[model samples]
Target: MATTTRERLISLLSDTNEYKSGQKLSEVLGCSRTAVWKHIEELRKEGYIVEAVQKKGYRITTRPNNLIPGEIKHQLDTKKLGHEIHYEESVASTQEIAHQHALKGAPEGSIVIADEQTSGRGRLGRAWHSPKRSGVWMSVILRPNIPPQKAPQLTLLAAVSVVQGIEEVTGVDAQIKWPNDILIDGKKVVGILTELQAEADRVNSVIIGIGINVNTPIEAFPDDIATIATSLKIASGKEVERAYLVRAILEKMEKLYHLYLDHGFAPIKLLWEGSAASLGKRVRVRTITGELYGNAQGITEEGVLLVEDDEGTIHRVYSADIDIPRES
Candidate 1:
């Protein structure tokens, strides 16, 4: 499998021994020396630090040092997610550019990422504070064979993936706040905005915009959000490598998306519940219609939030701003 080959190549390159010859790698990988050479060339095109010499063979020197297109391409070890990544130093919003690209028939695994966004956003058209070099503001163009009604489920799936990815990469226990927020130490570190393109009931593509606070300094946030906003650097007490985190996120999303396609939302819903912070807690949900004060029960099978108010009425909330109520 392509994934297996990629993994094996990474494992081999990670070996601390001196550069292993292509002939040796061919024998070890159980493939032809030409096959090993081809893999090395591919790695080079993707931005790896592969060192090829007449006698020394190929030895990966070091992973790229940035999250730019070249670096992300070089460090990626997955078969999907970012098989083709389009990165920009600045943009209005990746979602906007991704939608345009998807409309023009971009590949399913293509990812549109930006180091900074002039106008990033979240659900309900709220602004997402994404400053330059402080976070990941990116979107993916996915052409899934799913119905439009079930599009909301992808948001939850992404929430789960973001939490898992952040935890795996930064070693911080990030929690989910309902639909699409990854909170670490009770503060939001990640947010997702999922947009879909469909032909009535049929689907065209799903562009999922993700905003992750990576190396944000403590005092970087605005005064209002300073207490509530945080970064992986702050949560982990160390500055994490951005490219590795980006790759981890893409890998996690690709794996979860495959499962979602195989079996509706059941599996992802369970995982979301396990790490969710709002479920089973006293909460107040404010929606456009009105407010629903209740205890947060599990979400509906369709990804709608289920809340039981004080009157025992179960409210199926499609969209709401949820807050964990503080006791007097």
Candidate 2:
């Protein structure tokens, strides 16, 4: 990944504690001193606090709390997952951009991310509330050499990655609801949507869209979802760093994805089931066909939900909204 001029500028400013002279910056960045000043102004407009003195040139005192590529890729420890990042200030959806990139043969681990999603969506076309700079709204493109039918397992894998990532970052014990929801204290803090581009037998690419409510406050949620949706800030009582969380999730996803490709879904499934919240409970699963009320059994090898309804009937649920009933 070739670094942009702005990225190089940021790197230079961030690596040292003392200020960098304009002449020194221009010499290292291979640009005119006027151009270096323009870049510093641009950084200021993007919410970066670049302190400049008459003789002491410039130094970045603070960076914006946004998911700009420069901010995320700075010291990001990942082999492939976030090497190629497409960052936008606001977009309808990162998934839409990821699909286009995938069709154009973007490499695996290329990610599309945004500060705000104007038209973010969840499973079943539900509107996902993604305010600007309040959450982690991103999509990762992966070209895995596996059957298309095995794609759903990646959603489970992503859920596990997110659960582990959230715990690692915020010390919040997040749990996975069936399919693709991560909850803390029984309120949703993250959502995952996996889409695939495949031919009959060969898989082209898989786009995993992960939306995490990082620093959003409780009152910011819409009235309809306010009761059920929560953010990491609300759960952990501290402002979670969105960029760090994104890096952590990408690292975890890369590791788990390799594990799945090498060992199979057995290891991933065990890790997923360890953090599942709906298992071994009475729940109601609402599918497109109808609603089924039953005991929440374990997932199958293919990541299908197995729910045993009354009369000892086990229904295989490929996709559905699961609701775990509270104990009476």
lDDT score for residue 307 of model 2: 93
lDDT of 1 at 286: 88
> For residues 215-281, could you state the per-residue lDDT of candidate 1 as single tens digits?
9998989899998889999989998888788888888888999999998899999999999989889
Measured on C-alpha atoms, candidate 1 has an lDDT of 0.84
lDDT of 2 by residue, 161-204 (tens): 99988999999999999899999888999999999999999899
Angstrom error at residue 120, model 1: 1.2
> How many angstroms is residue 305 displaced in model 1 relative to the true structure, after the best TM-score fit?
0.5
User: Please, what is the TM-score per model?
Assistant: 0.82, 0.94
| Residue range with the least summed lDDT across 10 consecutive positions in model 2 | 8-17
Cα error, residue 300 of model 1, in Å, equals 1.0
